[model samples]
Target: MDRPSYGYSAADAPPPQGPTGGPSEQPVCPRHPDRVSYVRCKRCDRPACPDCQRPTDVGVLCVDCERELARQQASTRPRTAMGGRMGRGAPVVTYTLIALNVLVFVGQTLAPQIVEQLGIFAPFRALAMPWTFLTAGFLHGGVLHLALNMYALWIMGQYLERTLGPARYAALFLVSVLGGHTAVYVIADPMGYSWLTGTVGASGGVFGLFAAAFIVGRRMGGQVAQIGVLIALNLLITFTVPNISWQGHLGGLVLGAALTAGMYALRPKASPGADRQALARRSALVHGALVVAAVLLCAVLVAVKTLLVLGG
Candidate 1:
């Protein structure tokens, strides 16, 4: 680099002279068009001016020899996905699920259940009766009950969706509700079931979301005290409330936590380093296994209950 005698900035002068290039006559930095390069490579010990300096692990490398070494180093290093960083921090799926829940809730409140139906039930069964699990989440037994569960779902779900993304979050909610519904079926006198007081509300799903949030906090959150307080409050209300589905809520909560952990372990995360594709493949297998397991368990329970009744 050349410096004008009369008008010179610090950068206009060349770096110290050395074997590679005299500092007084070094090339300008490519990035900084007029900047002098002071660093000669540690390895080469040649004076490298700015234009020829190459980035390296510990220091700037000689441009002539270091490019090959840098390429090899990069190749050997484990690669990670560059995009979708902080994906866990922000996901559209979380907000969308929340919106859907609120929409369903509002619609259920205004619509007449007399002539119409709240269409949530058994999900993807042989019968494909989604109205069981689906409607159960939307319909509430009373105004207070509806308000409480909806608020809880919105609050905790916001966190779960942010952490787990849409698919896992939805899976967690449904699993939790199904756990609760399963508990109900186990204890209920449903053989004599009627249309009146059978099922309603998001308690099961909300409880599941709560459990997932707590588990997520335990695993990943820096502070878990808030999560603990949340669990405590929800449990207190479940027990104290006159018509709370205690079994449903508890079962759903436990199942949600366990399954969320399982999903996380199997896949680790949604992006970059977590091996998400592998996780998804394994999850699909696991889900199929769970569905089969649930069906068998239900069949056994129904058979045993029926057999006992007949004997009686």
Candidate 2:
């Protein structure tokens, strides 16, 4: 027995006790003091019950910490180069254009002279008033006209603006406006009509957006059949409706599809570790060229129409 004697160690000692010489009290949830919990918030290290806890990367966080983290993330969201909100957030460009159209309509109501000054007329009587080609897209003939155009704009503008970003969206709209007016100017007098025949509305731009949505949606693997049906229905209406500008709608649709196709063609193909900035620059240059080409084509068409009118 004397040969196997063991020495006393720390493990052999009695466990330490609290101030009252008893076992320590179990931790309880701050929110529910009666319920004992071992879980603690990763942020504040506060004891929290399962009901008050939110799982995170590191560990569970209390409800307050989770909400605060969410707020911080939302505040730091990225924006586009043009200082507009990025991604599929609110369509600021769409809303701004709508507001501008409404304001211009109100102004038109106040001063009837604005229609003559801003509306697009055939035969190019006032070539000096070239701004009318663009401005006419913002004008509305009447309340019903405005309501219909704005409704279409609201639906299509939101989709296109979200898909194409603000700068490209704005360019598409302006080009569509020009395209519509150009079409009217070129073919409006094939049978010798008056040069005073004028047109005004955002329908051209709206139709352009519709065309863009269809093209972009198809490219991105969306419901193509539905879009096609919608486009066909609209075309039917354009052709059947009395006083509707089929030329403008067709012109806008063609231009929109062409512009979007050009953009797709010019877009840099996906490759291993492609440089986004370089791709964006190249795309911008291509867009600028396309816009210039469209403008030149429009000018040529206007010049041709003017010569024809003068000759007649």
Candidate 3:
């Protein structure tokens, strides 16, 4: 003091202030009141401790804000190429098919004569009412039969419709039905089984859907054990149960698997120039080919059966 203080003294020092040039005040985390923090959340502008912070592209955000942002992003995600909306929307195809089946069942109940005309009979007689090949799929012998078949259809149709879209799904189903009837025509008479004379039910198409579900599930990396078990149980029932069409079920299963396999094989490969629309067109062509092949096979089967019966 006597020498006039060569070094700076305490009286000349600046006062301490907060980061924003205001008087210093301790800031506690909003989530944890006891924890003091100098950092603020980028989203909410509230004090956040390291434990409650989630780092983002802009800056760190609080846990609550981060959760909200994630929810928003998920809600805005786009639909898949196959028209699936990430669990949103009703399965329109499945519902329409169920309605049609129910309507047909009601009509069958009202007009009992429709069964004899529409139901598929032995191959020789079935040829006379060729349309019965498809009509039989819509006709059910009893309430329990209709209920079981419709229930199976509903369960499998939703998944397939979502995965394959409506047009492809419809084609697969119709082709599968034809395939089932074709199998019966080829096998029933040659086996000389009197009980297999008349066959009626949507079990053929239902079996086809079962096969489709298994194929799709496997493709999507899902566990297919349950589907396989269900298929096995149904097949066992088809062979062992009275009045069940084992031939139809086997034919449908084979055709469904073949059609799905064909589609998978024909799936368009990604290229720099090709767009999604182009790929969709190619897929449609594949489906068309499968349908045509199914129809031709049915015709050939009928012809062969007729020849064998005539020759014998």
Candidate 4:
């Protein structure tokens, strides 16, 4: 029953007016001041147009607020379970090692004379050319030799660098190389052809990585049978294959295993409420001292061997 329609329909109603009786001003988006918007961001409660809004878990946020929140989050870098600073998730140290090895190989190929200058010829000569103890690890005999070692280094370096942290992993590698060369020095017959043989390769450091990876895998409950098998096969090859330095491989493996065990045993106990940064620093200092001690042991071995060879 259509009586005289007294109530106004929405379409027929007048626009809302301000106190001055003029049309009310529309709220403009903070990001886009020219655009009028009734929708407000849940975060800052600012009027934001569709273009300036971002969907969040709770509600929509303004673009400015969302960007600021992201910036804050990015500033806080994350740490690994072992207290390694995980920056961008790339293994920087591993890649650096691979590059350095490749570059040195190139140098070796270009200038053949550099090989003698770098390779560990004999303990007696190593005394005069001390740098060979470290540099020899970077020299490879041929393309096949370089490829095999670089492949192994690439595989194991990435994992150890991340887990043990870069500095500790690097220490482990250097010490391993030193141990391998020292073994070669100690085991060689001073009056034999082995003494005159120049040994060059990253086999020492690579074997060390194998031992470390095995220990780490066993600790983390990972499947380590494959690593064990690989090591056994390599050891077999070291004995069977002619020109292979069995002494170096065995020495590096033994020392690497021992050092890794010590480092893990000394690691600070994890606590939910403990300060990770503090714990990581403590672990670093302890691990660093252990590495230094290992180096000293290698030095002592070399010194004693040097005296014996010279005296005889």
The top-ranked prediction according to lDDT is 4
lDDT of each: 0.59, 0.75, 0.75, 0.80
Off by over 4 Å in 2: 1-88
After best superposition, candidate 3 residue 44: deviation in angstroms? Answer: 39
Question: Which candidate would rank higher by TM-score, 1 or 4?
Answer: 4
lDDT of 1: 0.59
Candidate 4, position 286, lDDT: 84
Please tell me which model should have the higher TM-score, number 1 or number 3.
3
Q: Which pairs in model 2 have colliding backbones?
A: none
Give me the runs in candidate 3 sitting further than 4 Å from their true place.
1-88, 190-196
| Candidate 2 residue lDDT tens string, 46-145 | 6678998898779897776787777666545553332223656688888899998998899888987855466655544548788888888888889999
Local accuracy of candidate 4 as per-residue lDDT tens digits, 11-56: 2323445567666676666556567778766656667789998888
TM-score of 4: 0.73
Report the C-alpha lDDT of model 3 over 27-127, residue by residue, as the tens digit: 76756756677777776666678899888889997787788777666445543333223334787877877887788888877877865566655565677
Residues 85-166, candidate 1: write the lDDT tens digits: 1234454655665566567667766875741253644212312443464456656656677667767777786766656655
C-alpha lDDT of residue 188 in model 2: 81
Off by over 4 Å in 1: 1-91, 106-110, 114-130, 190-196, 268-312
TM-score for each predicted model, relative to the true structure:
0.56, 0.70, 0.70, 0.73
The backbone clash count of each candidate, in order, is 18, 0, 0, 0
Query: Which residue runs does candidate 4 get wrong by more than 4 Å?
Result: 1-82, 119-121
